[model samples]
Target: MSQKPSKSTAPEAENAAATRGTRLFLGLSCFLAGAAMMIIEICAYRLLAPFFGNSVYTWTALIGVILIAFSAGGYLGGHLADRKMALDLLGWLLSGSAVLTFFIPALHTVFAAGLSAQGLIAGPVIISLLLFAVPGILLGAVSPAAVRFYSLTLKDTHVGAAAGTISMLGSLGSFVGTFLSGFFLLSTFGVRSIFFGTAALLLVLAVAAFLLAKNTLRQQAPVILSGLFAFFMSWMTAPKPKPGVIFEHESFYHHIEVSERTDGDVTRRVLQLDSTMEGGMDAKTGDLILPYQQYWKLALLREPAKVGSALFIGAGAFGMPENVSREFPEAAVDVVEIDPQVIEVGRKFFKLDEHPRVKAHAGDARRYLLQSGGKKWDMIFGDAYNGIRQIPPHLATQEFYQQIADHLEPKGVFIMNIIAAITGPKAELTSGMLATVRKVFPHVEVFAVGYRRDETQNVILMASREDLKPLIQDRYVQQGSWQESLIKTHVPKGTVPHASYVFTDDHNPVDAIIARGLLE
Candidate 1:
């Protein structure tokens, strides 16, 4: 206290304090950036879902393209950081990303209409690349640049450790982002809100960047004006028009829409989003009508009492639930669908509101089943996928099927739809899936819908604990009111060929399966 501190010692101490603060700040920023990137990926899926029905091909293409884009951004960001580690550049980059984030919702309507005209392959591929590439590249640039800037500000001691700490935080943030997008953001905010929320977070990031660059900030006027312009332009624009009756709403997790032919005095309402037509309902009478009606007819082979309670995964258009409720009026029906907007659409467009016997739970089918506390069912229907893309991997897992097996009653039936290339070599996929089910269920059956026995394209799989051979015997002679009135009038054929292959979580190459069918 008596001796005044040396000038050299005082400056070093101050530098150490400043360095510690900057490192903490950089760690926080990196965390935010990682989360933002993941959110972008999740939202991209939501964006693509309407045009493509969550098919294996669609999921593969989307994810593969995103990974490629991220790789490209990594290269580009590293190059940019080498040239300049300025905090000003970092702020602008975040600001630019925010601008793009804000515009995505507005752009999606236009992009979808364009896809409809040009086709998803020719249109969506190009559109997604153009719209998303730059922002992705800019985002990729953030982590490297942040580390570089931190290196400049920090005292030379433990520079590598500090950079590593920031990197660790970023990775942790990414993990958090993946879960948050699915479990929290999508399920709570709806699609539009997620986009807007992402923009707000980016705005906060930009502000932080600006503060860090206070001493280095160049002409702030232009940056402020540019940001204002981007936001205004994005907010002022309206959604693009479509020819069909487009009904859009945010159901916590997804942007659900139902579009139909308005001019025709048709009784059917097409319940669709992206490419998956959840189901259809009679526009006039609100009666449930969908391809699933044919699937339900498979139950005709089972003992009537054995089919008492039913659990339907993916309660789209609520057609199956409504039909099941009508058939087994006393049955306790449990319907699990992830999208809340889909449920709302079911109520408004599909008369789900009037159906008192069915209870709809808005959550992922797998998580719900695992956590459903030993609730068993006589018939568990897994109608979880559609379109040329968008199939969720978790639902198609070996574990999920095992859970289905554990939850099913002794004489229960488990059915799921697999879009096969009904033609050529693709038939093996249907065969493979049948084989997979037979691995556990003892008996497996197939019903080729929208195609002839001779025609190969899309097929439905019906598996059972007991032999379907007995049901095959009664299929022709046995008569129920629904069987005689409904299925016999439509399918006419009492039985279809069963495929010999089984699909497991590890080996199910459904995309290649569809591609073989399509190419063949």
Candidate 2:
């Protein structure tokens, strides 16, 4: 019908398809490289987290250091490419990445413990910096080299288009890297596995580059050989956790550790969730005590007759769940935590397995809430974060509170704990939190659990549609629970009046608030 499409056009179309396919492949390779680099960067923090608290400063420093290294590498890569543009260089660079990745575990172990074992934290940092410098430099060089190689092959304007596309692909890979590592690998496979997984991806890229560059590009045997040799040496030095050690890892998410505890006749093991020591219990006795006893008081505050079901967002060691089960035998308790290793540790060492009434879901709290499908709760606990950062951004937002509100029954109470130090205008952080809750809940009541006169106090905020005055009066601090007993008597009364500030997703500056609190 179309005057018989020219036969020559068929071959042209096929050639176009082939070219698109090749470009697609190249883009994918670059994407994977980007992902692998990011994976290494994120996992490195997890490796260090057990030793260094996963502080905001630690994360910032790690990112800043890597970015600086990357910038230098990019400059060097571009200069080398301009001097001599060759696919072989790309292959060599990729091979180097693979070698560095494969050796990361060994290097990390040596850097973390080998030097620190001698009581020298500074020595470990120096060794780590040295070990990381080369790999970080090489990884940083990848993008610029890739851009140069692709740009040299393209026409004037195509160079700009290709560069933009490649950069976008790299960003996409970064997004995937963070999500996959956080939701899956870091939670299930542990930090070491994440390194190996990323390294394997780089190894595949290296092989692909080598094959494509052979014969078409100059010889790069020496670089490849050096990489292989380094990988082999590091493989030999890889550290292994000692046998009978139930669990051991470092991660940004949490300082992870679990060891089998055998004391007297009790053959069972105990789990320690963090260095901060939030969750732990007797493996055999399943006896929750002290600090845990304070957490258990929350369950008792619930209307005894009405508390039919409860949701514990961060059941670190399942101590709270165990206590809930013991006190409310008929209540259905659901625990949703991000880390499965934590649950495993709980079962192996924290007596989590002994509690038959509790059901555990291993996933992020948000994912759990969304998937649970309109299930109403009697009480929702917002004890998911440590005082280190007030609350996780996702959890502190107005939308999150709305979700919490959705999950609660008509008379249901939502309890949250926040650490704040000032009662004056400096109490903006507390005000912000109250303001966030006030957006949804009409009334917010904060009962100072510890000494109200102290500059720093742990205050329990209960938000509900119904009044909680009776509950706060009879069952809270005045009732003299184990929680109230720990409070210092000298609570500070601020001369300045409290300010009313709100924390919505759009305006909550928790980091700034935290900084101000520290300053005060």
* Top model number, lDDT: 1
lDDT of each candidate versus the true structure = 0.69, 0.66
Candidate 1 has an lDDT of 0.69
Worst 10 residues of 1 by lDDT: 488-497
Q: Relative to the unseen true structure, what is the C-alpha lDDT of residue 67 in candidate 2, on a scale of 0 to 100?
A: 76
List TM-scores for all candidates, in order. 0.76, 0.68
lDDT by residue (tens digit), candidate 1, 1-520: 4998687998889878866776677777788878988887776777776664455544555666667777787776667877976677777778888778777767775666566444434445665676677677777777777777677775446669757876788899899988999778776776766877787788777877777667434555555566666666766765554556568765544556676653365566786665556677777765655554557657756767335788999876777778788878888888999877677777777778787989999888988988998889888888876544435656765667888999998888887876664434545565556556667777766666664554544466777778776665456643665545433323222233355444566766655554444445
The collision pairs in model 2 are 46-250, 46-251, 261-269, 269-349, 453-491, 453-492, 454-491, 454-492
- lDDT computed for candidate 2: 0.66
- Give the residue spans of candidate 2 off by over 4 A: 1-32, 48-72, 85-88, 95-137, 143-188, 196-245, 249-255, 260-276, 290-293, 298-306, 366-375, 387-390, 402-412, 419-459, 463-500, 515-520
